[model samples]
Each structure stands twice: as structure tokens, then as C-alpha cells.
Target: MIYEICVDSVAGVRAAKEAGAHRAELCANLLEGGTTPSLGLIRAARRVTGIGIHVIIRPRGGDFLFDDDEYAIMQTDIAAARQEGADGVVIGLLTAEGDVDAERTRALIALARPLSVTFHRAFDMARDPFAALETLISLGVDRILTSGQEASVLEGLPLISELIKRAGERIIIMPGGGITPRNAGRIVQAAHPKETHFAALTAEPGGMRFRRDHVFMGGELRPPEFDRLVTSGQIIRTVMKNTTG
Candidate 1:
């Protein structure tokens, strides 16, 4: 099994590699459910790590729904990521009515051609998961990143299992959200996924402290969002070794 760790910063990507992650999904703002990283950060990550770096192609936060200009931006970003030597790209698109925008999605996939495309968690918001899966498979998507339509994968295990059964090895069903070393073992045993995604980050905002009264500029925690049970390289490798062994 492969583990895809979400890294919002160049530092996080290096830390993920030290933790033995097979791949890193590079993004700018994990707090907004991940967005595309800048060329500088992407190049910095590439220079520092050998792990596969799959960049998120989201232009902004808020919703997976996109307009014409936003789609154009995404296409341009995909080309940039490919040229920058990204191992893969993560993206998704939904209609204003909350359904898969098949034509637009297909076009994006074409732009990301030859580079692996992961239909991000926007898959969870689809009106119909089964039909949507069919559309993605028909569009020749490589994989899907989803929490099985629930707020968390643990809560959505039944649907995840059902999805795995129905998928029948056609496309990858990668479970994400609320997954951790503690629960990852159970999730893997239940869903039998070939891959999983998580952000192993420690809530140590104080260590990078400048001044508590430095409110002149309101700081935002970028990338590798959220606190977790295990944030150390040791914890990540130990859990992965135990689970995949």
C-alpha cells in the first residue's frame, strides 16, 4: 500500500519524506481544503525531496464549482505543474447545481494528460456517487480522493466498502479526511484500498512564534492544516510499517 501525505509547505514536504511517505500532495492552503502551490514552493520541494510530489490544481477556496475563467486557470496550472516535473496533479470540478461537470472535468483531465489526475474530495459532494464514479471512469480518470460521502471515512466505512466492491479495480478509491495512524489500520483492513491520504501535522504554532503582540499582520497557518495524534516522522513510519507489513 502507498501513503499520500498532504504537505502545504516546502518544509512539510521534506518532513513527509523523512517520515517515509511514498508521495506528497503539495498544496498552498490546506485550511481551505487545499489549493495550488506557487512555482517557487513547487521548485523548492522538487529540489529538496525525491518523493513523488502531486500538486493540487485548485485556484481558490470555497467550492469545487468553477467558472470559465477558473477552468482556464486550472488548465494553465496543470501545464505548469507538468513542466515543473510534478509526479501527478489533484483536481475536481462540479456544476453550479452540485453535480459533476463532465465536459469541463474531461477537459481538465485532458490538460493533465500523462500526469496522474485525482478527482479530489469534491467527489463526496456529488449528487450521485455511483453515477459520478461511472462518469469519472468513462472520462479515464486515474483515481478519486474521497471520504466516502461522509464527514469522515470512519463514519462512512460502509459506503466506502460498497464503493470498493462496486469499483472492482476499475479506478482507485482513496479514502481521506479524519484518517489517522490510530484509525488507518482499521480503514485499510475494511476498505482494502491500495492507497490512503492524510496530513500528519503538529499544532506547534508557538514554536514559530515571532511576537504574541505582533498583530500588525494577522498570521495565517498555511498548509498541513489541523492537529493530529501523530506528527513525528517516527510515528508515521511506525504506523505505515505496522499496517503495510
Candidate 2:
């Protein structure tokens, strides 16, 4: 089993390597459910870790539908990811009608070239998983990181198993989302996937000693401003053992 750790920081990249992860999907703004990481961060992560770097190519959060400018930005980001020696990238696009934007998606896949592309969790937001899976397979996507169109992988394991069985050798169905050590083994046993993705993140108190009130940098539930989120090597090893054993 390949433990693909989702990371939002360069430190997380190093931690993933230390914990024996097979790959790390790099992104930023986890509070917004992960956007594209900066080119600098991608390069820094490459310098620090030897594991596969799969950068997320999301232009923003909130919706999978992107405008022309957003599509342009995604194209640029994919180029930057390759220029920085990234091993692969993660991307997804959808139509307003809740279907895969195959035209634009195929264009981006063409631009991404030799880098392996995993259709990200936007697969979960699709109106239909089986249809989207077929679309991805036809477009030559390397994998699909999905939670079976549910809130969590465990909640959608049955669908994941079905997708995996149907997928056969056509494409990879990598289960991710709210996967923890306790349930990682269960997911592996049920889904029987070749790969799984999780963050294994922990929060550490910020360095500031001063106190403030009634202030926040985010619009939604945010991690404590004084707490920095990071990947935990212990959690990585724990989940890996549970899944692989």
C-alpha cells in the first residue's frame, strides 16, 4: 500500500519523507480545503524531500467551476509545477451542469505532459462517480482521489470498493478524506486500493506570547491563529502500519 500524505508546508514534505510516505501532495490554505502551493514552496519542498511531489493545481476554493482566467492560472501553475521538477500534479475541473469539463480538463492534461495527474477530490463533487470515472479514464488521468461522493472515505467505502472493482486496471481509485489510523486499515481491507491519501496533521502553538481578542484572519472555522498546522511523522507511521499490516 502507498501512503500518500497531503501536505501544505515544506516542513510537512520533510516530515512525510521521514515517516516513510511514498508520496506527498503539496497544496496551501488547507482551511479552504487546499489550493495551489506557491512555486517557491514547491521548489523548497523538492529540495528538502526525495518523495514524489504531487502539487495541487486548484486556483481557489468554494467551487470546482472555474472561469477563463482561473483556467489560465491553472495552466500556468501546472507549468510551474513541472518547471520546478515536481513528480506529478493534482487537478480537477467541472461544468456548471455538474459534469466533468472534459474539454478544458483534457487541455490541461496535455499541458501537464509527462507529469502524472491525479483527478483530485473534485471527483467527490461530481454529479455521478461512474460517469466521471469513465471520463477520467478516457482522458488518461493517472488516478482519481475520491471519497465516493461522500463526506468521508469511511462513509463511502462501499462505493469506493465498487469503483475499485469496476476500475480493474483501467485507472487508479485512491481513497482519501477523513482517513485516520483506526479506519485506514478498514478502508484498505474494504476498498483494496493500491494507494490512500491522508494528512496526518497536528497543530502546534504559535510563537507569539501576546493575547488578542475578537479577531480572526478567516471567514470560516479557522485553526487558532497562534497554532500552526503541520504533518506528524508519528501519525504517518501509525496509519501506514495499520493499512499495510
Candidate 3:
């Protein structure tokens, strides 16, 4: 089973490589659901890790619908990914009607040229996943990163299995979202996919930073937070050894 870990920063990408992750989904602002990382980060990741770098080509945080300008930005990002020696590009786009925007996606794919393309999780929000998968395959997408149309993979395993079966040799069905080491094996067994994606971060015991003097109008601290694991190199190595052994 191949493990594709999400990395929101250059440090996270390096950590993922140390942990034995097969690939890193390069993005920024994970809190905003992952936007495109900067060109410098992309180049730095390539120089630092030999593992596959799949750059997320998303322009912003909200909604999958892209304006013409955003679409143009995606095109530039795709070309930049290629110039940076990225292995592949991950992107998602939908029509205003909540369906796959095949025409626009095809345009981006054409610009991607030599790099592989994996349609991102915008698949989960589609009006009809099965139909959308068909469209992605027809567009020659290398893969689809989906959560089976639910909040988590465990909840969507049944549909994911169906998608895998339907996909056959046409395209790859890569499952993501809430995939943990404990359930990774189970999901792989159920979906029988060629790969899987997960962000395995352990709570860092006291990593959240805040100003103690800072308070809201009511004189209460905003909220306490904790540090989360960015998927340590050690964890990745152990998981890989366990899974591949």
C-alpha cells in the first residue's frame, strides 16, 4: 500500500520524506483546506526529497467553482509545477451546476503535459460522483482523490469499493480523508486501491501558541489549542515498514 501524506509546509515535506511516505501532496493553509504552495516551496521540496511531489493547483479556499481569472491562475500553476520538476499535479474544478467542469479541467490537463494529473477531492462535492468519475476518466485524469462522498473514508468505503470496481483499468481510485494508520489496512483491503492518502499528525502535547494577555470583548481567552503531529519521519518509516513488510 502506497502512503501519500499531505504537507502544508516545506518542513512537513521533509518530515514526510524521512517518515517513508511515498509522496507528499504539497499545499499551503491546510486550515483553509489546502491551496497552492508558493513556487519557492515547490522548488525547495524537489531539491530536498526524492519522493513524488504532487502540487495542489487550487487558487483559493472556498468553493470549487473557479472564475476565469482563477482558471488562468491554475494554468500558470500547472506550468510552474512542471518547471519545478514536480512529478504530478492535483487539481479540482466544478461547473456552476455542481458537476465536473470537464472542458476547463481538460485545458489544465493539456498544460500539465508531462506531469500526471489527479483530480482532487472536489469530487466529494459533486452532484453525482459516479458520473463525475466517468468524466474524469474520459478527460484522461491519472487518478481521483476522493473520500467516497462522505466526511470520512470509513463512512464511504462501500462506495469507494464500487468506484474501484467500476474504474477497473480506466483510472485509479485513491481514497483520502480521515485515513489513519489503524484503519489504513482496512480501507486498502476494502477498496483494493493502488494507493491511499492521509495526514497522520499526533497532538504535539503543547504546540499551540497564543497570547495569555489577549482576550475577547468578554475578557475570555479566544481558545486553547494543541500542537498536532505533522507525520514525523519516524512514524512514516514505521508505518511503511509495517505496511510493506
The best candidate in terms of lDDT: 2
Minimum summed lDDT over a 10-residue window in model 2 is located at: 213-222
How do the residues 19-131 of candidate 1 rate in per-residue lDDT, one tens digit apiece?
Answer: 88888999986668889999999888887657999999999998888888998899999999999899899998998777888998888888888899899999999999999
Model 1 lDDT at residue 87: 85
In the range 97-156, model 2's lDDT, one tens digit per residue, is 889999999999999999999999989989988999999999999999999888999999
Off by over 4 Å in 1: 205-231
Count backbone clashes in candidate 1: 0
By the lDDT metric, which is better: model 2 or model 3? 2
Local distance difference test, per candidate?
Answer: 0.84, 0.92, 0.85
What are the candidates' C-alpha RMSDs? 3.2, 1.1, 3.3
Model 2 TM-score, all chains together: 0.97
Q: What ranking of all candidate models by lDDT puts the best one first?
A: 2, 3, 1
| lDDT for each residue of candidate 3 in 21-44, tens digit (9 for 90 to 100) | 789999986767799999999998
User: Which one wins on TM-score?
Assistant: 2
RMSD of model 2 against the true structure = 1.1
